[model samples]
Target: MDMKKYRSTMKRILGCISRYQWGVAASLACAFVTVILTLYVPILTGRAIDCIAGAGAVDFPRMWKILKQIGIITAITAASQWLMSHINHWVTYRVVKDIRTQAFNKLEILPLKYIDSHSHGDMINRIIADIDQFSDGLLMGFTQLFTGVLTILGTLVFMFSMNPAITIVVVLVTPVSLFAAGFIARRTYRMFKMQSQTRGELTSLVEEMLGNQKVVKAFRHEADAQEQFENINEELRIWSLKATFFSSITNPATRFVNSLVYASVGIAGAIASINGLLSVGQLASFLSYANQYTKPFNEISGVVTELQNALASAARVFELIDAKPQVPEDPDAAVLNNARGEVSLEHVYFSYNPEVPLIEDMNLKVLPGQRIAIVGPTGCGKSTVINLLMRFYDVTCGSIQVDGTDVRHMTRQSLRTNYGMVLQETWLKSGTIRENIAYGNPEASEEEIILAAKEAHAHGFIRRMPQGYDTVISEDGGNLSQGQKQLLCIARVMLCLPPMLILDEATSSIDTRTEIKIQKAFSKMMEGRTSFIVAHRLSTIREADVILVMRDGHIIEQGTHESLIFQNGFYAQLYNSQFAV
Candidate 1:
């Protein structure tokens, strides 16, 4: 384990907890009171024992006084412990909540590349599972650790006052416990980290399989998927057991050391009492202090093991919270408003990977209210163009301009707000149809939502639902047909009616009949608006004002559909091939 990284992670964890300064102070005060009073009670009990062992009749009044004091101390200690427990819980959970919130907020501003590269399930595990583990470890630390250390110190002080020799014996044996616990903890930290990572991988694998069970079943790859899952599961099991084994060793090792300390303290106290160096009361107090002193070692050793795991888990959470966010917008960036939809790509170049070019020196210009169609084969940068235009990914070189202003100069939110997009993949949250339709324009009225749905030819099916527009769609529109889900997504964009529109196979899932109806609706929607259509079907874009045929990241043909067909080039061959088959 890198001690420096662990130390850094610990300091950050402390910083998060320190936000609740009042709670920390309160818990500290309670712990101090509880441990002091708890240690003091043993002295009181020893005094009561001395009263009973007196040569004459037992000093009943003195015994009664000591017992009363012990009772009061016990009550106060219990009350302080209760308050401390509540405060610790409050502080620990608040820290957890704060960290979880920061992780989620980081996700929002993170670049698309990060989201595309990382596993969603692993991210979810970090936010949920790892944080919960951190919470458990932190809560244990707050509840046991502070008091344990204080109790140890308090016992040493009391034992020293009673008899220095016995106190020395107890102190001399402590390093053994510390050494044993530290040795095991150092090795366990790495194992726990691997355990957490493997658990995340397992979560990602399970999530992948569950999310695509249909594909697995269709492909008849159940046996293969099962074998893959078992491999990950077996790896997770190994890491978990190894981590658990090493951590478990810490407790027993510390306990054995603690037992030796207790035995030495008992032997030394007996000798001291026999030699007239201590009274019976003092010797009894010494034994009690020894037990109290050594008890914390066992507790702290367990805490140390947990802290190792907590630190490991915290490192992962911190990694996410500290992840580099998307490039910051200019402090004085212009906000695009009421855009006229004149978009231009001036020598724009982009690639998902720097090593392999995807779109190079791509140039295009669209007049306001013109329909531009982009047709290309797979992996030909069609959607990449849309992504660059939407600012989902920035260009590697040159610039894209909207309304004669470079898009990079505009705030992403304002730029995105002005353009409505509907892709082939439909997304619907679990909500009423009306709510999903109004997601883009949340303030839209019921009539407006219905109008957009009707325009997208989705109103008929929606109205037939048990509750019409109020019918709650299941997760991802599981209750609805794929075409219906696509229609809802289309209605969503239609409701926004942005100044600029991008329809990338927007009607792919709909049947041919609904496709034609939706096409008519789209035609009305696109009128007087700048639209970019990315279509694989040649039949869809024959009337486009400008057709840009792209191949290998370059636009090789650009003209009206008739002109491109007349050229008998790549575009003509592509258009004729669809008809030929």
Candidate 2:
């Protein structure tokens, strides 16, 4: 929508293309050769006609030789076109691959809040559809535009040299037609941009529906989902039609203009021949050049339409590529090594949005090897604390320190490497159980993986499966039970053996018996590790060295479990409500 932004994106795209300048040069050379060959065809036809009319003993052998030469030239032209296409494809694909890699790297560095604000479907569309569209544009659009321009220039020079009167008639109509074509192209481009955005929205809607298919079935919301999809689909169709209509108009308008100019050239050439100003061979040659000259305008109009479409796609793709990550580490930040696990949050205040503070003046200290449990009502900043500690979001005020070093002063990789985390929802890629366990510690030996699995109490169950530790799991561990998925996460964390651990509702989904089994494994994993637990079930955190109760962006209470129970405060009330028989 913004012209400045569009210009900036174009600059970036040009810069990317400049990286493969040699390949682009080779492609352009091939396009020029093909155009040159194409222009020679009309001249050759005119020569053959002139020879036939002269009646010079009818040189059939010479005619055959000329025909063979034209055939050879045609074959070479085809080969040149093919080479140009392959080169364009190679360059476009390489640039697109680099763009995708850079986009993903940018995503990795961006803060969690950026991802939270963007939809999964929209991002996926940019990565897949937008990039694919850009590739198409760069490959086909470049070749067509370059060749069309070259063909037009070569034809113009030859036409004027053959006969200026006919050349002028044909040339006079070109600017008006080009101006009309440009206006139509601009309208089509705007429609194309809107169509791309709407398609992304449609893709997002379908993804959401499929992801929540269980919810939709349970609530019998099939009709609602269908209606929502139809709305987006209709909008997409309208935009698509507008783009198609405008693009379709350009070719017909161009052809009509070309027809008018061709008629003018014929009439003017006939007059010159009648006035004895031009010979029959010259008149015929002028008409042939007239057609050749008009061919480029037709080619230009078509290429302009295609380029408009490609440019629209390029603009969308570049918008994402140009987005700056929300969080950036200092260039001089140092990597931490052998970090002591002592963490302190000093008078910290933070918010995802500045208007709504999620955590305010939060102060806490965790001694090395101490296990602290954070209990709170939903949306009471329990998870926000973990986010801040991990530097997923920076504090708006005060500071957080790990081992007396400011977190902001340390490299993000170093800070994260010192801690291990187990989330409420277990996520695993489609791979063998062994691969998932060794994900955090890629260099961990087979013996170490087996030991970690044994420690997490996952060895028995995994061995019972068809492939034992080598059994393949679906992405997100869909093939495994909820309990088994949690165990896999635990084994992954255990393999890392980070000094600091954060267990975020780790047993929230397991049954009572499985919870007990997991809790025992968790206790072993937590030993001598500085750990933070966010739990809704009070019984699970009863043995925590310290418990902090949080509410409405503040710490409401802090004490040991026994002391809090004796005090009969928020923690005690929550415990009585959940644990009472």
Candidate 3:
């Protein structure tokens, strides 16, 4: 890990902790008391030892009194430790909650392009798994880190007061443990970071496979998927082992140095006792102080290992929280209200990638209440046009307007609320059928919801459900057939009944008879509303007032269906191919 980055992450971690200033102060005070009381016990023990002047000459009352004091101090120390532990938990979890909330909110405002380009599973891992890891590391830091440092400092002060020469021996030999831990920590951080990244990749792969299980099975790609999973799993395992190996050595290596320090203190103290520089009881106390001083090194080494994992996870989560959001909506933008839907694209240009131009210098105009149909082969910018019209992706150049007002000057919420959309891919949240239909207009009356469902030809199946319209659907309408799910989506749009409409293969999943019925219903609903229909089936758009035949992101032909057929152009060829038999 870069030392600079490590410091930066630590600073951010501290900044998060700074929010609960009172909690931190309370925890520190408890830790200070616990360490101070704990260190004082050894001094009382030394005095108790001195009171036992030989076997029979023991000062029984004095020994008993000292023992009582020791017992009282121990009880208080335990209570302080307990309070500190709880405080640490309170602060650590609150910080985790704040960071996780921030990360989630960032996702909400992120541009669709970022979400489209990244793996869903990886994003979920950063929000969930990485944050959990960070919390664990933070808990450990709050629990042991402060206490361990104080214990070390307190022990050194007590030891130096007892004997300066022995204190120097401990202080001199301590650098070896510090050096060992630091060396291991530096190498382990990079290994742990790689391990975290691999884990995210594995999660993404699993999520993709699970979500498309039907397609995977249809193609019999199970073995290939297993192979890919195994490859990523094996990579995660390797990195985990390497990180664990390096971190695991830290404890034993430090313990070995600590043991050597203990021995050196013992030998030096014994010589001083013999030379009449210290008493036997004082020597015992010095040895106790030496043990106390070195024990923190063992705890701190473990903390170092955990801290590396935590810091690695923190970096990943922070990356997500710090991602740039979509460009801010203008505060003073116009609010499109009851739009007349005179939509137009004026010299528009767009591409998913700047290097690979898809649409360029495109223009079109639609009068209010006109039913315009857009037909094109796949990858011909049909959907891209819809995306720009809805401001899901802004035009790379030029302007799109509604009711003669530049869309860039309109508030997104008001602009989107003016249009009702039904697409080939239907999405329904887990909820009752009534709730799903009312999703766009939550305040819609029950009668209104049922009327919309009936218009979409979905009321029959919805009434047959166990709870009628109140029947709850599983995620993405998993319990419903594809055609049934599409109807519910249509019903949702019908309930909204915006001034403008967009139907992109809206009836593709329904049977022909049902499609015809819904198409008639749609015709009535769109009687005086401007509507854009994108269809591959040429027969469905025959009644469209105008047909825009697009190819390679450019409009190659434009006319009514009859006129296009008379011209015998690309639209005629596309229409004829469907009825070739």
Best by lDDT: 3
Q: What is the number of residue pairs that collide in model 3? A: 0
Candidate 1 on 1-581: residue-level lDDT in tens? Answer: 99899889999998998789999999999999999999998889888888887688699999999999999999999999999999999999999999999999999999999999999999999999999999999999999999999998888888887777777878788999888988888899999999999999989988988878889999999999999889989999999999989888877888788789878988887888789887788778877888888888889888888988889999999999999998899998899998898999999989999999899988898999999999979999999999999999999999999999888898999999999999988899999998999999999998899899999999899989999999998888988999999999999999999899999999888899989899899899999899999999988888789999999999999999999999999999998888894
Query: Tens-digit lDDT track for model 3 on 210-327?
Result: 8889999999999999999999999999999999999999999999998999999999999999998888788888888888888989999999999999999999988888888877
* lDDT by candidate, in order shown: 0.91, 0.84, 0.93
Q: How well does candidate 1 match the true structure in TM-score terms?
A: 0.98
User: What does candidate 2's lDDT look like per residue over 310-401, in tens digits?
Assistant: 67777766666667676677889878887778999999999888887688888998899999999989999989898988888889999999
Query: How do the candidates rank by lDDT, highest first?
Result: 3, 1, 2
Shift in Å, residue 472, candidate 2: 2.6
TM-score of each: 0.98, 0.96, 0.97
Clashes of 2: 0
Give the C-alpha lDDT of model 1.
0.91
Which candidate leads the pack in TM-score?
A: 1
Q: For model 1, state the Cα shift of residue 40 in Å.
A: 0.4
The positional error of residue 106 in candidate 1, measured at the CA in angstroms, is 0.6
Candidate 3 has a TM-score of: 0.97
